[model samples]
Target chain A: MMLLQATGLVAGYGRPVVGPVDIALHRGEVLGLAGPNGAGKSTLLAALAGSVRCFAGSILRAPGVALSWQTQRQPAVAGIPLNGRELLALTGAAPAGLPPWLASRLEERLDRLSGGQLQFLHLWACLQAPAEVILLDEPTNNLDPDGVAALAAAIAQRAAAGAGILLVSHDERFVTATCQRQVLLKGAAES
Target chain B: MNVELLFDPLFLWPCLTGMVFALLLPLCGAYLRLRGEWLAALSYAQMAAAGGLGAMALGWPLALGGPAAAFLAAGVKNVFEEAAESVRGAAYAMLLLAGWGVAVLLAANLPLAERLGHALSDGQLYFTDQGHFFAALGALAVALPALAGLSRPLLLSHFYPDFYRARGRSARRLHLAFDLLVAGVLALATTGIGVMAAFALVFIPPLAAAPWAGSWRRALVLGGGLGVFAHLLAFALALVLDQPYGPVLALLLVALGAGSALLAQGHSRIAK
Candidate 1:
């Protein structure tokens, strides 16, 4: 059975402007959502992950699907401060063991972490979620070469273990290295 | 009048310690709110204030004021705080009616008992006196331990998404716990009397700060600052107005909140 499915899903923030397209993710499948800026890449990921309300159509999913959105902005919680490990753990995906560099980096605040560190840790945390399906938005925004490589390796490992991975990214290198398939949203033509 | 009571070690301890705790609670709350837990903190603060007011009213000594007037204040705060988002539009109206009701009731019932009723109405019912100030300070002290206690859960929710997700612990629980505690303390402080003024403390300062406070820390600092300013201002205003001090203070806080909002808006627009 497909671990996740979104059929004719349409959603947006203020107005209904995003999608009515169909998407499906089977276990062990990794899909890269490719699109131009404002092409609803993040919005689509939000809808699929259940963070966003679907304007139309339906999203079917396994019971415990967890989404660790690489939100374009910083993550915040009221009255408390947090670092990388705490963020991942808050999202229900703290990796058991990190390569020493990552472990040391996690000790620092997420807001202060280098972009690359933030990107790598986001993916690493998502992969650890117990959910069958995971969604990430623009997961490669701040990654350096090494960070990109680590993310790719982590996604690959998780996919091999039968978790469905969905990500939106403008980084062609990241898409090619981590994703097995790509869905390009041809703007204006479909909208 | 009661110099010994004012300096009583027990009374002074809660008052002095409470100010310290009160000051820190918002800092922690601001941090949590910045991390995206404002809802939790707000909920807790509201509940705690309501319960505290009720307790204060119930425990109120007739010698200091009396129970009837105390309950009136608690009733107002309780009603004001519980109304949800949809009914928020009605807060001003509700608050006004509460004030009017208390005014009418006092005037009708205490026609012969002028000076005593007026003093009690001012002090016990409206938080206009030094005693109320001391009590508010003490409550703040109480909140310090509560803030420290809530920190771990709040931080875990912020940094450890997995922990939050797995535990399904929304800061709502924290808010509820806080609200209940505050309400109890407020009950004790007001003896059910100074609902309107207590309500002012909870809402006005934060509302006054929200527009200009770009972050939670800024908001909390602004709120706490406003709180102190309002209390001091109310004290001065009461002395000047020669009316019951608590109502006058509540009105002043509202005015200050409005002025702050206007100033913040103008400043933001000018900067833009």
Candidate 2:
């Protein structure tokens, strides 16, 4: 089922940074937006998340649909007393499906965890949220091999559970293995 | 020690008032610290003082002047919040200076305003009347439940900001409402506890407990508990030492802050 549809989308900050493009996300499917640096790949995700301004075009969501966005760069959380389990709870993401690698460390403060471990926890939270649409920007950054496998399995499970996911990532192999379709941009679309 | 004075009926209202402020300040302070706008406590307090003085100068009752000016300050910051599309912290610095400047100006022009200013700055907890005790009671009644309702979304707004924007909703409105609530509480706190003492209750407890909290609930617990503890201790010490409540409260918190900082150095929250 079509969960979200954007028609003739033109998205950007104040000026156009991406699109004059089109995309739609459907339940039970994973969509990949693949492109070079500055191709507005991240901007596209921001537009969909409604963080950046949308200059033109329209995004339509089916009634009562919810979304989760995992941004490309998270704000500094160091020295904050929040732990991984509490962080997950913010998104209403439970720990039931978290891989053992991260599950064992959920009790530790987020700042105390290593980079790859922290990255995986963030991904897991968004992937596991109750939202039907998940937008992930460079979700693979800082992730190790085991973390990647866990993420792949998670994506499959969430999609099977009727989620529609749109992700922007530079990890070509991860994208090829997980996404059934890829939309590639030839040149930089951010102006 | 003048510990007996704490139970004196003449001092009953002041002690009750002090205890009520102890509860109200830290609860609101936790959210202010969470939002990184702890300065709002001082800014709102100054604006209230300025508002009260401005009312005095114009022959208006303080009750009419203080909240009205604070409401304007909250509204101004809310407008800044919308224009900037950022958190309320962005506009607080400017508001702080403006409020202070207006207060100084108004205080210089009116002798009564000047006395009130001195009373506001030097601490008036010992002199808080029955009305002030009731005001503190009313503030506690209003602020505690409101802060509880605002906690979740504010936390989520900090951790997962896109959650609101994605739904085509803005956190600015949430911020404005919170600012107005905070302004009301801070105004009452300023009038009862004096500005420095009120600011201490609002800033110190939250900062001291922030590094120790493993969860949001724990953060609030530690912060609120610390606030009440330090406040009651300060109140007793001020009475015993024949010191003004404001400086004594500020000094005790500074002592607590020094202790907290030292303790944090040896502490580790990492699980095996």
Please, what is the whole-model Cα lDDT of each candidate in the order they appear?
Answer: 0.56, 0.82
TM per prediction: 0.54, 0.93
Report the C-alpha displacement of residue B237, candidate 2, in angstroms. Answer: 1.2
- lDDT per residue for candidate 1 within A82-141, as digits (tens), equals 456656654566566665678877656565566567667766765676766777777767
| Candidate 1 Cα errors over 4 Å, as ranges | A64-67, A76-81, A109-112, A187-191, B1-272
* DockQ of candidate 2 relative to the true structure: 0.57
Please state the CAPRI-style docking class of candidate 2: medium
Per-residue lDDT tens digits of candidate 1, residues B1-272? 33354434444333433233334333543543343323333333233333333333446544233223333433443454435644533543454454445444544555433333343334443332456556656655676677657655655544544434433455445544544444444434333234445555555666666665544345667877776666555544444444554687678878987898689669868876
TM-score, cand. 1: 0.54
lDDT per residue for candidate 2 within B145-250, as digits (tens), equals: 8888887677778777776577566688888889899888877777788778888999888788877888667877888888888878888888887888899889
- Report the number of the highest-DockQ candidate: 2
